[model samples]
Target: MKRFFQSIISSNSVALRTRGLLLLSLLLITTTFNASATCVRKDFSDSGGDLYGTSLRLGNINLTSDDLQPVGTVLATSVVNLFPSVGLTNPDTVMFECDLADANNIYQAFATNGDSNVGGFTNFGDNYFQTFFRYTALKLTNVESGVEFTRIWQKVPITHYATVGNKIQIRGRDFSPIRAELIKTDKYDPTPATNSFGCPGPSAIGYTGNYTCPQPNGYVAFSGPGVELEELGHDANLDWTSWGLVRYYALGMNLGPVSTLTNNNTCGVVSTTPLVTFAKISPAELTAGGNRTGSFNVQIKCQDGVESGVQHGQTSIAIQTSMPAYVAAQKINLVNGSGGVSYLLSDGYGTDSSVATGVGIRLEDSKGVTRYFTGWAPCDSTCASSDNSGWYPVLSNADSVGESGGYTTYESTYTAILEAIPGQTPKAGKVDATAYVLVKVQ
Candidate 1:
């Protein structure tokens, strides 16, 4: 009985050990399977015919929550150099194949250097191997929620590659996020006046537009307050350019809708239209033998579409002339005496003798000079009839004589004289002379 019990115990112990060993093996197998399931594969090839069947393998990598994390290792035993033959063209399309069955949740893929000393996370040093392209997370099978595999092909022109020995690496990631791929194509066009907006108008024929101004010296100007209009021309980019030619004065627009209002005011406010007229010249001054000329500019602001007919308005210029002189000549008669001497002059004509009395005189020195003098009458109290007291000098050198008591009724006669200034001359026919005096009896 003791022998039989020992046999049973040993067998049971062996059975337990065997079971333990089997379970350990099962655990190991499961770990390896899981690791292999999450790993990614990468490959490269030239889409163009220059290079053929070039292949490289990137080894197993761990899977992150939503992305596959590269193991930071390059599995390919041989390093290929492709820089000499073909250069990278569509770098973003390099293919990356993942082994995982559930391929949907991949979000991003990144390239990193492979040199161990270069480290993994942040040691993106030059010594490390780098991937040529990466892909965004894309939906694969409905049953899976991560990336299954991605195919990227790059095609380059023959001239682009110098030789066939170029090689590039690629790595991928898997995540539960959506990924987007971007493609770009570019083209350039260089034809002006191709579109309506780009078509510079007739004024731009000779490169004239808002952007071009005529030489200031070539044109006359009369711009209004806000009525300046710009010249038209082409810009640096061959685009049309123009500007406003404004006027300094206020312009009336009473002929348009803008000028009509309930208010009694006549001032007009309207859009500005520019019109230029050739300059006009006028005779400003004219003399007997000389002439003067003047010039001015004219500009108009009218409604567009208005007829280009005649416009009427009035403006004034000053007119002036120099003053003229007049002269006359006459004969004088004098009575000398006991009674004061009396004198008289004919009023140029003996007709109505009236004794050219109280003559007034005016003298103009030269062509441009003018002067005047007044005459005085004799006083009654001082020069009574028989007393030779009231006589006064008539000309600059003449003496005063009076009534009855001065001489014994003598009839002495005096002559009258008229003189002219040294250098003063009169206008053609404007000189005159005459005289008058008082007489008394004893």
Candidate 2:
């Protein structure tokens, strides 16, 4: 009888305990868990490419003899087709974008001067400005271009979307039309581990996957951020030969949806090179009596059958030729001249009441387009308005180097003349001046 009574009590206790647990489980199911004084937002379904050790190629840029001597030389660059859609390709939808942050998550801002390393390198070398590091700036936007980007990750705390298109190409008082020299040096090296993010030591690997940006001479860069992410497009290997000590910038990716969104763009980015030759005769003495002519040419020769592309650093692409300098004098930086100051008279020369003896220059090509220039200002900013220069859309004819209407390399010579200012008296002062010719290809 006592044993029976004890069993009944045990059964009652087990039943009661089970009922209590069920009630508590129901209550817990409705309540949301939160960390101490913080909120963590996460997407459980986001499966994307690894941000660590990812290198998307941005086509190699072969440095000219002039490219190696500069402190802040551009390692390489290519046309970044960011947000290239006619109908629904605006910024409303979530698209793939290149992350500008380094390991520390720093990026560029705006500037009046050409300097745009505003985020400043921290962490790995937080705010540490070394030799090459000091001049090694990564700029994209400028006051002239009127577009800028602030600190960013794919999941931005705020909406820092650009109004038109975000660009890493540097511009300031200049760069009205020139889109070259867009360096993306977004700093974010906030770490103690040199392996993850820091300047490379001699003979040591600079990046995680063995792309050493050697110190003192070399610096690292990221892919263009504003490029439009796509699921399918042209695919070509980047075929550029890296020159000098400047190591190639490894194209990286972001975590989560950003990487997921850029699934195809990461593989489709190519570094293509077009043949641009300039028989530049700058510092040529201008005579009031005659015109000294110089020649500039941009020839694109391709493999007979292979189309042009950049992903593999190939120098094969169909390009249109134009005098990009005349169109973009404010932003054109020659290998051996001061930018935005071309043809502007040097100091010590008085011109209060002088005739419009402004340096005279003329540009002409086989397409029968001619444009003239006289001095700086009132024209430098508005010079391209009257640009009727011939821009040839030369297709790839390299395979037929000597054939009918096709040469392995189709070369065109454009004449650039430096003469006295038209209808103006020749000044009696010195005639030492440079007429810089900037050849642009599309």
Candidate 3:
């Protein structure tokens, strides 16, 4: 019976081994087929059209629809108080005790504290929160353990949102019962009546000293901190006389940190009068000359625009005349025996010439050679024997001529004079001259 049992066992073992091999072959074949189906092909599209399959991996492994979870929620409750919350309001500074570990864990804090999820969790750890209820990155020191940590945070100050009588949210954290004290600012009166320049004229004026506005006249009182009177004036047309509330703010204070609230004590008021300006030009006097010509420079000045009470505008100068037929003339004459015997003359005077006068007379011989003479001469003349007859007599007197009938005269044999004074000569053109004159008379 033992031998038969062993033989049966050995046969069963062989059969089992054969069956296992078949099963392994079938599994391999099935796996190969599945892998081929999953492999990317030239024409194959991914399950969701995500060519890179990133969305597929994320959806399948990390964010499966079946495993979806709701976003975390957090509740923060705190309160802070600000002092000197009146006048030129400043931000309030308040200290908050937060768990260092929790603050450093940006992901946990944002998820649990209802804080904003900004880029880079590291930045959240570095910056903290402020009394202005705004998130800010800050360097935090764990005093309990002497370890330093950074976190993005926000604070709630008593003065924050006090004007509207609403509580400020700190990094989405809620606060209640915040206490704010009214701050006393140095009183500033910008009233022109109180200023050295006195009340503003019909013009714009600058602030010189600590200006104050009278309480009853064209002025309103400020009640809360962070109110901007100057900005209010700008919006209200610089008329501070109206009895309504105006927005007021300080120049260099940070609006976020509660610590800046220390500067709230400074305050100022402005008059309601609107700035005005008036200007005029001096009347001009006209002058007349021989040609009905005259000119005057206009002077312009403002009556009230300048701080010194004198604002001047640009002055324009121009000239005007009515005479178009005005002209000028010069005279000269010709002479002979000084050189050649013949010359042609052309006076600078044009057709408008009422009278002709010589400028320069040229004497040319029959050969066309030329000589020039200037100045006037009397009539042709003859010289007496006592006058040394060998010397030719100047043409000033006809009796001084050496021999009057020796030379023949022709109509073309006249004197030649320049019609105009040649100012400059061109390289290949006629010379240009000034034919007109300008005169100034008082």
Query: How do the residues 351-406 of candidate 2 rate in per-residue lDDT, one tens digit apiece?
Result: 33332233434555555455333212111111121121221123322222343222
Q: Give candidate 3 regions above 4 Å deviation.
A: 1-361, 377-442
TM-score of each: 0.12, 0.28, 0.11
Task: Tell me the tens digit of each residue's lDDT in model 3 across 260-295.
Answer: 111011101111112111121111211111111111
- Local lDDT at 165 for model 2: 42
Against the true structure, whose lDDT is highest? Answer: 2
lDDT of 1 by residue, 1-442 (tens): 0001124334587898987898999999778766554322233333212122111111111111111112332211111112111222333433333323322322222111111111111112221211211111111110112221111111111111111123211221111111111111111112222221211221211221121111010011111112111211111112111111111001011001111101010111111112212222111211122211122111112222222211111111100000011111112212123222222122332333332222212222213222121112111212122222222111111122322322111111222212222222212221133322211110
What lDDT score is found at residue 54 in candidate 3?
Answer: 11
Sort by lDDT, best first: what order?
2, 1, 3
Q: TM-score of predicted model 3?
A: 0.11
lDDT of candidate model 1 versus the reference: 0.19
Model 3 lDDT at residue 144: 17
The C-alpha lDDT values of all candidates are 0.19, 0.26, 0.19
Quote the positional error of residue 396 for candidate 2 in Å.
Answer: 11
